[model samples]
Target: MNTRDLLNRRAPVRRAPASNPAMFLFGALLCAAAVAVTYWAFVRTTTGQLADESAWREAEGAMPGTKLPVLQFLDSLPLLSLFIAGAVVLAVTIKRRRLAPAVIALGTFAAANVSSQLLKRFFFDRPDRGVVTLDFNSLPSGHTTLAASAAAVVFLLASPRWRPAVAAVGGSYAVLAGAATFINLWHRPADVVASFLVVGTWTLIGGLIMLRVTPDWNYWPPGGRGRGTAPVFAAMCWIPGLLALVISVGCYLYATKSMTALGSSEAMLLYFWSGLGLIIGVGYVLSALACWLFSIQAGDQDR
Candidate 1:
């Protein structure tokens, strides 16, 4: 065989993930659990509300003089950004001749966004839990949903070789966008978390379907970048994410020293970082989860 034929012969294909349905089911169920827990913690408990609202109030100009660059980043990724990225997703999928993936991506995108609005408007209710907060439901942030769903589209269409990096960076952007929404007082911490879970559910579903319909392009080749790259990319996301989680917990712990201090500026700022950290850390974790799941499902393709 010539050099080209020799390389093709040696090109390792990953195991088809579609053979096992359990991974997708578990991921979807996990997303549902996360959303339920977030809602219960923030809307059903006084402490949760106090913590959520403290962070919300902080963003209502607690740090009057300081400005964050993240806000600018958020502004940059407006609805127009979604349109552009979505177009790119479509273009790439079409170019690769992956019609099933394209359709699935678009379907999930629409389903996820509609689900968020429907859940917020008609389904979910914020009861008067004696927290003195808004009664209207805002559990799942619309901005976050929009951003994450867009990222999900890209994730679904990406091949295994690139999905790890895409998952980490895209998830970070979407999650950080949620932080901007709450920091600007558009939503609460729970709202952002809820949005992430919502998008995650749909993404998982899409992944499962795509695996069944289009496993041809879902595989990673062996001996190219080596097998270590995927985990490395995932680590790039979750490492900082876990550290932020730790910091957020520490901030919350210190802020809760006294009852009266809960509403103080210090407490409010502390809560601000806490909420930011939660969103960031969760975003990273989810991204890493995607990396891990896809890696396993799309192992060296079946011969």
Candidate 2:
């Protein structure tokens, strides 16, 4: 056999089940749980409102004399760019017969965004929950939702070989977009977090739908050139996520005493930065989780 033929013969083909009922059910459960938790946290609990308000106040000019036009720019990222990128990625990566999955994945973005708006307007009611804030419920910031949903859809459209890289880049973008909301005082930490969860839940459901439709298209080849990208992407995600968690914990520990008094400006600033770090950490962790959840195996290809 030729060298190319020899390699193909030696390389193992990955395989996945025709339908993953467990993953689909798990995704559904996760989506429901996220919605419940978000609603309970933002609308049902007084402590939730208090914590949210404190975070909001700290984020909104906690340092004083600081202006964040750049944050504003990040918060105002255009949705059209997201749509265009999704279209381009789908065009390049998806096969003609596999177009249905891509279309469903892209539609997930719109569904997720609309859900956030509807939840904010109709379902989540902030009726004098003891925390001082605006009248409207803002548990899930619309901007953060849009950013995170965009990231999630991109991940869904990516091939298994490219998923890790997409996850890393997309997670970073989502985290920055979330942090920008906090920095600009446009949303509380909880708001951004809820948005992430919302996108994650929807992405899970959408991914399962894709997997169900394109069971044969999602696999990795042994000894493939693209094999390296997955592990590299995982490393990138874990390192930053773990570091951010450590930093957030340390900051919280350092500021604990001052937080009781709610008096020290330094403490508040520390908390603010720590909260931002936590957002980054959580975004990446969830992105990584989503990648894991959507992973499916298929028969080996001829190539």
Candidate 3:
């Protein structure tokens, strides 16, 4: 068959109009920032003092008063659950004739897993406490990352008609996973925050990639035209990107005890808010720029 005939036969084979190389580059830069943050939070904290001793004791004291089935489940199958969930999502997507979404979800899961492992290995050292701790590499909690990544992918693949509902479900899962990890004393609050950052950034990148592969899929706005330029695509991505940033900042502030503990001498409240404001501000500006650039490109193309 001629090239044109093959192209006609597989009309959906073309790269997603939304998957701009520039976006991929932007995503990479964000991932790098996440990695740096993870290193600083996990690695740097581990060095100063094996605070795990006090942290463990505190955890034990706190554990007696709490009943957490979800935490128990998380401790029992930290990494395993994510893989199983990813497989199930992939299977369901295939059955529904939405193989691309499934593939995108699974692929993102795999990439996140590998990245977590690499980070763990690079910063290998046994936890200063917790005899029952899984293995080396405490920074950027893998369990949390898996949960967030899977939840984000599920949100992306959900039908536009059901996107909000699906996003709610995914958000619930992500929260449960984070709580489970924290209550079980498996990961520090900072580790959980970093996980959200890294996994979330990658998930957005994956969604953008999927957009490129299927521009007509209308992954946003619940029933809008799929074939559009970068601006529309950027707008679709911006929602989740902003959400991720908001969640990350909230997690960081809460985990670091910056929001609570008012009227205390140790209140570095201003510092926390300042840092969070800067990150959020930069993220918003970048997203706006992406949208503007895409809009300009679309306009020029029309002309």
Candidate 4:
């Protein structure tokens, strides 16, 4: 080869994007801890059981007019639906030449749903908390798992710049599904929270593997400058996420400290909204965290 040609070919190699191993590892552990705490607090303790039961009963009061449509949406998503969604996502990823991230995201989805079922059926059980509930345990809702894991998969496989918008829209759908289950009395508040934590845990684990194998494309625009989606969607997620959490806390504390006599309808409504708040808060907060983490870890893609 000519000397000029050789020199032209000797350009500097760009570094791959950075990954957040610590965030992925400890974030998963934190999710697991949250799941355990949710189960124990809402399933094992008498007060927790009472509160959970109250919320469930209040949800039962929801008219069929309100609950029927939600049931329809939930029923439309059978096991086969998951497979179809998975296949479509896989095909899209492979088309874009992102085989590794696709596999990890899909695996995360499957693992989360399976774990939730196993925990409900074989492992975790409600031990006679004496709150007048049903005989079988149903902690960690199946419906919520299906919905949330589906959302998480899309979020994981998306480009970092698009994650915030995806998170807002997709996370809202998951929360809506979770809330639907709660409203229809299919599951308690604790059950939905457990599913959220389960999805979060699996997502972080998948993210750990995804970062190791595919770091080059896991990046976003650093500032709100040029050709990026405005942080509008991120604000959409953050505002509701923080508001729901604070209001949920207030609902719980108010219920605890209320001068009203026990079991008043008003107090029951408080507990109900509190449970719903947990659903919305945990779901959106996870989305917001994803937005922030990818922005921080992936660095400026434009550079």
Candidate 5:
């Protein structure tokens, strides 16, 4: 070939997207740390122990007939219903004909629940500790685990374009279900928080797997397809989380001081509600973060 022909014979090169696998790995590690810290606080720390028992005692009062029926109904939702719904969502929303995302998404639910149960049964024990709380371990509530895990599955199954809305709505559902448990005295605040962390951990791991197995379809475009309200959803998470943190800290301090001075007073009741709000806020925050994390661009295809 002549020199002119040689200069024109350049080969096209395909470059990878800006997304880094290390980011997902870091997210997974961060989630794991959250779970570990939450578990340790509940099981080992004096303040954590006192706070949990106080919240439980404050929440364990008699409930009205109206609220009892509602909470009981929420608690009685069948596991099969979640599986069926998850299957349907997976069938409908998945644009690409890939099995890895679906299988890993569903597996996340199982992993989270099984891990929670195993931890509750064998790993952690709630000591008597001279308190009136139950001796049995209930750090990660089984009911909350079911709710949060189900939400994670739905979030995973949703299309990348719809994930923000799914994260907001589904996170709200999980939060409400967890709140119902606290309102009905089914679990303490720490129990629900631990359940959230467990679900977050498994969901992050599942998200990393999805990124690896289906990088092409698992990301947002450069201009972002101009779809989804992830930023709005993230704002929803941050606003409530900040407010709840302030309220919960105040209530926690009050409860700690009042146990000796006022005993089981209105302060304890305030503490219970505030702690419950904190759990819900944290749940939403984690869900929103996961939604954003999973939306990272997978490859240069969309760009």
Candidate 6:
């Protein structure tokens, strides 16, 4: 075989996109920060000296609806769905001879689960007053962390053209799980926030590590097609944006109804809306940024 034939054969072997060392470093720092924050928060909550145990207790008391059926149903769905989806994604990717995403996805799940448990065990000694029955650690909600990590992994494997849509769906599911935990009084608001931080930090770290280690892996983004910015590309991007908007709005509305039903005062309602707005705004902006970055990177590769 001549040099030209060898070169032609090698051309089809896609180079893995360069992993940003900075991103990996940042991810490590963030993961450590999450651990520290979780530990501190857990200690505070458990010690009963942290900020307003009374407030947490009051919030727990304000939980609406009977816990017998609805809470059980919602709680079961998120974790189960997360596991099932992750398993399916893993299976399909492996069958297609794409191993990196599957491995990374599993690793991400494991990391999130471990971190969440550690936080829970460290922070919470017992359930709050409103919690009639107890099962797991309560500091950083396990369900929320699982949902967030699973959704993030799924988004990473999706086609750039389809990422927004998948992310929107996945994000909505995650939010729903968080809401269920909150409304059920299973965890405080801070616990949900910590869970997100932990999951996101680890997923970013795991993804960066996988990309760095397997520079030729084409498992993610499947088909190995370079990014593009063709006119049709705008439509593909918009689809996810639109989906995200819908989901965000839906979640906000649901949260509003739940809060109102629980008879939250006007001041508390305002705070809720403000917090919800911030989360949705940040999510949309980040989604847009991810799409833009993907387009630029893909376009350059295509060129």
Clashes of 4: 0
Identify the candidate with maximal lDDT. 1
lDDT of 3 by residue, 247-303 (tens): 656644563464332222123333233223323333333434434433322211110
For model 1 the TM-score comes to 0.88
lDDT for every model?
0.80, 0.71, 0.53, 0.79, 0.72, 0.54
Q: Pairing residues by index, what is the TM-score of model 5?
A: 0.84
- Candidate 4 Cα misplacement greater than 4 A, ranges: 1-15, 79-84, 221-231, 259-263, 266-268
171-232 per-residue lDDT for model 4 (tens digits) = 89889888988988889989999998999899889877877777765755444232245266
Look at candidate 4 and give me any clashing residue pairs.
none
Q: Write the per-residue lDDT of candidate 5 for residues 1-303, one digit (tens) a residue.
A: 999998988654334545566876787778778777887887666667767766666665534454667566565744643864577556755656777767888889899999999989998876655555576778798888888888888777766677777788778878887887777777878889888888888887877776667666554545556344667776777777667777887777766665532236544476676667678678877876876776654333233
Estimate the lDDT of model 1. 0.80
Which residue pairs show collisions in model 5? Answer: none
Candidate 6 stretches with Cα past 4 Å from truth are: 1-18, 31-70, 123-137, 216-303
Candidate 2: clashing pairs of residues = 15-297, 16-297, 16-298
Residue 241 accuracy (lDDT) in model 3: 48
lDDT of 1 by residue, 119-235 (tens): 889888888767777878897888888888888888888888888888887887787688778777778988998999999998999899988887776666654343577889889
Against the hidden reference, what TM-scores do the models get? 0.88, 0.82, 0.57, 0.88, 0.84, 0.62
lDDT tens digits, residue span 1-303, model 6: 998898767333333464565855665576568556654654344432122132244444344455555488565876686776677676659776777767776787788888788767774554453323343446677777777777767766665556546655665666666656655666654566567677666756765665566544422343434333322444443454456456545644564555533234333443333333323333333334444433333311221
Better of 1 and 6 by lDDT: 1
C-alpha-based local distance difference test score of model 5: 0.72
Q: lDDT of model 3 at residue 270?
A: 32
